[model samples]
Target: MDVYYFTEFPYAEFPESEAEKFPSMRLTFPNTYFDPNKAHDLFKRYLDEYQHAEDVGFDGLMINEHHNTPSCMDVEVNITGGILARTTSKAKILMLGNMLPTSDNPPRLAEEIAMLDVISGGRIVSGFVRGIGIESWANNTNPVYNRERFEECHDLIIKAWTTPGPFRWEGKHYQYRAVNPWMLPIQKPHPPVWVPGTGSPETVEWAAKNRYTYAAFLTPLDVAQGLFARYREYAAADGWEAAPDNFAFMVCCHVNDTEEKAQEAGKAFLWRMNHPLRGPREYWSPPGYTSRAGAAAVAQRRPTPLNELSYEELQSRYHLVVGNPDSVTRQLRHIKDTLGVGALLLEAQGGPLSHHDTMRSLELMGREVIPALKD
Candidate 1:
């Protein structure tokens, strides 16, 4: 199993009457806070912590991309990439990817990533994501066309990385005079590509068809297993014997001497992290957001806006693992045994856990859980 320490770099602020509030703790609340000065130092800590993950023996360190949100730091992948290049060695740097269709120029992404690959001495696990929900609105894209745009963007970027340079290229979403990337990746052909998904049928099918490794983003284990099973079935039918080694699953985790202590810590952090007393009552849906199926499914359960969905609802809808190291390990082992997933994306960030608490969870996993899993 490939162990990874992932960070969300959640924003934090102190209140006179209460503990510091973690911004990325809940999806129900609208981000109504900001401070430019605190951001710099907070980001530095985030980087330090990420580097520490490598020192502690995680096989991989991960960074993701997002924009116009206080939920996560380092909106630009290049900045994160540069920090990782100077920080550590050995651990694969997984940029769970930049949103391709939303990007105006895919070549720029290809070039920058290739450069990072070269600088990192070939430690790059490139992830490709089609921007999610409101991201389409944020990027001024039509969500309906996101899948199509993603496919075209992927093709164009690949050609740019491999083909001889300065070749004219024209595509629906992008047009370029030169088909060559300025910087070629250190890894032959390209860095291994991982695709993160939210259980979309087309995405599952596509990942299987292309033989790309798929990482289940935030779905529950049972659901994740079901989705992987579907992917496995597709792979098998196409003449590939799929095994547990074919997929990756993600889970939120915490650890302590006892389950109660861990739960208390997790709950306390979540409570402190809850920014709003109630949920947002807005469309929250950005234009061109293409989660018609997801939306319909939620509607069947209870008609409500995105922001209004209750905390319990979110947990039920998405399988989020929250428990001590042993409990977490058991759940993961169950997933591996039943679902046949080979790797895990351990989300070092829970909805509202502090840096101290997050590190504790990570350390416990490294010291106790990982060894057991390996056995």
Candidate 2:
């Protein structure tokens, strides 16, 4: 299986020794507490290390997008474009991807994607997402219209890339008087389309129907296995062959010589995982957001005043696969076999974990777990 590291580039610092001295690290904390220049340097280090993953024979490098969340360095997709443009050859660069519908000018996405594909010598796997709950508020988009906007945007983007262009196009959400794209992507038809999500049924069906690769983010292995099975069932119903190559799953992983050592290295991260960085509550999803139901049902599943949910509950639900290489291997093998997943996105960086801990985890994963899986 191929492995890709998820980098958040979180600010690294120790908490106050006296509990009473500092206020609690609440959910609404700003993510980039470190100096901007220092964060830039840290990001460069991450890129260098990611390149080393390819050197160690990983299948590819992965990058994602987020905004105003301490969870990641917001706008890293643009950074991915730069990395793919200048970094070493080979190893498909998966922009797992930009929030297309929310972008006022969707064609800019098409243009930038084509530019990146050309610069990277046609190595790019594009993953489109409707984005998450808070994004609605951040982007001034109606969460209610997210699904419609996304479907329309996806069609528009593919058309912009594939059609001869220089034509007028109009849709419910977008309009274009002159539809002429200056550049076409190097990948035939278009770069491979992969969609990432967290067990959304509509997404599963859409991915299955379109034959797009599905990557589940921030979910436990047990749950991910079930989700993948559902995807396969849909693929089968659609009269398609569901193979290992068709799916990918994300795992929050860290490995070391021993489980105890690994736990020690990642305890702070576990603590952070138990901590929620921000919320208006209810996964921050707006009413009537999901395709399966109206805003009321969505609200029921994700209650309002989302802040009421404690950090510990979030951690227990989200954090999984924190152990030694052998333990991680056993868990991953089971999930891979169960889900028929072709690739695994190994997220080594999370919460407030130390960079040293993350680097050590990556090394062990590459040297121990990944090699064993290969054999």
Candidate 3:
């Protein structure tokens, strides 16, 4: 499996208890807590870490975008992708990815991603996502139109990359009289498109139909198995076998010299499972954001909210892996074997994990854990 280093680039500089005052540490959370001077330092450190992950021999670097939350500082993956493209020489740049529904211009989105692919010498994996319910609130995008907009935007972007334009686009959520862009991806038929989900059936089906990779994020092993099985069933219906390359899995990961130190350092990840994920239901799932079936699938997929899981439970569930190099390697290998996935997206940095520990973990992953999994 190809191991990709990822970070939400969390800004956990404040008290976790403070989040209780808002619906969630997201859209409605007050910006009084934001200190730009601190954030300036954070951005620099996180970028440095990304470069280091590549230097240490990670196969890829995955970046994501979010809004109104300290959970993820990257508000625009394209901006980060541009920076990484210019700075890093190797490693796939997976942008998981532009929020199609929240974007107003599909052609612009296509151009920016194409530019990154060009800048990176074809090392780009374009991912499409339906922003979470909170994103609808954050961007003031109508929740009811989320899926529709996502599909339309995806169609337009794909056309912009594949069809030689000045082609006209007329769709339900978007329309363009002239669609032409000088920038095009280095990868023929555009860079590979991947889609992520927590086992949303529609998402799995859509991804399967398009033959795009389906990355299951933070779902338990069993839940991911079921989702991948569903994808296989979809592919079978179309008379083709889905390869392991068709699947990917993402989870929190940290490795140190010993399990004891790893556990201590891994505490930083707890904040990620807590405050940002803690919130009233209304804040997390606004009306119409999820279909009844999708919401039901999500509710049943996990036994409990991530914040409620003890560290041991988290490890047992494979939500997070913190251990010595050998142990971490074993756990990740089990995930690889159990899922038959081609990619492992490792969130090696999270919460307030110190720069020292983050770098150490990445170093160990490069030196030991990643290689073990490869064999």
The numbered model that scores best in TM-score is: 3
* Model 1 lDDT tens row, 189-241: 88887888765767888888877889987565566776787888899999997
Please provide, for model 3 over 1-375, each residue's C-alpha lDDT reduced to its tens digit, 9 standing for 90 to 100. Answer: 799999988888899889987778888788889999999999999999999999998999999999999899899999999999999999999999899999999999999999999989999999999988888889999988898999999999999999998999888889899999999999998899999998678999999999999999999999999999999999999999999999999999999999899999998888898878887787777888888999998898876999899988889999999999999999999999999999999999877899999999999999898888888
In model 1, residue pairs whose N, Cα or C atoms come closer than 3 Å (at least 3 residues apart or on different chains), thus clashing, are 25-351, 143-288, 220-319, 244-340
Evaluate residue 256 in candidate 2 and report its C-alpha lDDT on the 0 to 100 scale: 70
Candidate 2 lands at a TM-score of 0.85
Measured on C-alpha atoms, candidate 2 has an lDDT of 0.70
Deviation in angstroms for 212 in model 2? 0.6
- Computed on alpha carbons, the lDDT of every model, listed in order, comes to 0.70, 0.70, 0.93
Residues 254-323, candidate 2, lDDT per residue (tens digit)? 7777878876765555533433334344445566566544344333433422223343343344445667
Q: TM-score per candidate, in order?
A: 0.85, 0.85, 0.99
Indicate whether candidate 2 or candidate 3 has the larger TM-score.
3
- Summed backbone clashes in each candidate are 4, 7, 0
The positional error of residue 113 in candidate 1, measured at the CA in angstroms, is 0.7
Evaluation by lDDT, superior candidate among 2 and 3: 3
Rank by lDDT, descending? 3, 2, 1
What candidate 2 gets wrong by more than 4 Å, as runs, is 12-34, 276-278, 291-319
Query: How do these models rank on TM-score, best leading?
Result: 3, 2, 1
